[model samples]
Target: MVTANKKKIGLLMVLPAIILFIIMTIYPFAYMIYASFTDLDLSKANTGKIIGLRNYLDIFKDQLAISSIEFTALMVLIAVPVEMVLGLALSYLIRNLIGEKILRALFLIPMMVPAAVGGFGWKMLFNFIFGPVNYFLNLFGIQSIEWFGRPGSARIAVLIVEIWQWAPFVFLILYAALQALPRDILDAGKVDGAGGWKLFLHIELPLLRPIFYVTLLLRVIDVLRTFDIVYMTTYGGPGSATSTWSFYAYKVTVSYGWNIGYGSALCVILIIVSAILINTLTKVLNIGRELGLSKE
Candidate 1:
């Protein structure tokens, strides 16, 4: 009876937060769904009406939207895998080195910085005429390249800043996972003449695989929503060349376009895509079982 009462007390304590979530999150999303089917231009708020699937269909016709989708996809595909691999490698590299604790903290400095600030700093660092990067390149007999002037270089610059900021996040999580492994199991592998890469491949990799998939899924979801960095650094230009779906949606809804209905439609599409990707990844990784997310 005491245990059951405690459970009820706990539920009662959390009841307010549950209600707040419904008010704050559920209501807005439900409204967004209603708005997406309308021609709800913010410029003439009261003059809008439902327009069926036109807002969604119009997405393909917009060149900027198409480019933004492509750019967002490119970032997810490139950044997540690279960060995961690089972070895993760094975690292994610093496992037992002298002053490893200090080194780990130092490596995490970039991750600690806010994304907008980091992007702005990188923007200055990559300045064509007088940036430190160009000065260093000059020492190596390379010409100062215009990072922001060209679309390709601007995209690359954004990618580099993202990788620099996020790789440490991946490293921290993976390193913690690596440290939490069973020492006794590792010692047994060492006893069986398994050292170096051999031990890692056969034993450590299998043990670490679940955490890796979880991290990969996290990075994918995060990179898909990247916007702050692009906004700070490139402002979604070299002429909208580096615009992300999130940034573009913001533009359509609030910033430049003032088309709330269209932006809501774009947001709905993004949400659907994210749901599909997350569901697929969860099933393929079988992470639900690993994370005890399943009743089984």
Candidate 2:
């Protein structure tokens, strides 16, 4: 009887939270899904009427949407690999350094700064007239080049800011993974004539595979949804060279057009693409585990 009463009390305690979740998260998500099938302009939000898959169909025909998708894919492909390689190398180098803790803390400063603040700071650094970048180039007899004024430069600027701000996060995760590795296995490998690159390539890397996959997955999702830096620095200007999918959706919803329904459709598409990518990565991680690559 006492156990039964405790179970009932526990259920009662969680009931309110469950109700709140349904109201706040589940309901809003369902509503958004519904809205994606309609014409929900902010001008007449209350008069939204269902238009089936028209909104979804329209997105493929939208050139800006296509461009944003391409740019976002490119950013993820380039930035994630660059960050992963740099982070792994830095973590390995710093692990054997004096004052390693202090060094780690210093590296984490970029991650600690607010995104908007970092974006604004980078914007100033990349400014055309008074920016230090242009000043340095001028000292070399190079003419002032616009960092955000041209399409290629604008894309490069976004990639630079993103890598600078987020590489520290990847480094921290990888460093922790490296530190937590089993010393017994490493000592065994060393005794078995496994040293330097041979030991790392065969043992350390296999153990770190799981953490690496997790970090890559997270960075991919983040780069896909990137908006703040682009908004602050370029505003998707110079012919939408740096507009990610999330930024494109924002432009449609609030910046350029007030088409909420279409924006919701874009959000849905983004969600779908992210889900598929995450699912595929999870499968790859599982495969790695099954092949005896991942430790735990």
Q: Which candidate number has the best TM-score?
A: 1
- Model 2, 1-296: lDDT tens digits are 57988999999999999999999999989988999999999866475899999999999999999989999998989988999998988888897689999999999999999988999999999999999989999999999889999999999999999999899999999999999999999999999999888988999998888788888888988988999989988999789889999999999999988898999999999999999988898786684564466676
lDDT of each: 0.91, 0.91
Which residue pairs in model 2 clash with each other? none
Model 1 per-residue lDDT tens digits across residues 81-164: 889999999998898899999999999999999877788799899999889999999999999989999999888988999899
TM-scores for every candidate against the unseen true structure: 0.93, 0.92
Q: Which ranges of candidate 2 are over 4 A from the true structure?
A: 44-46, 285-296
Model 1 ranges with Cα > 4 A deviation: 2-15, 289-296
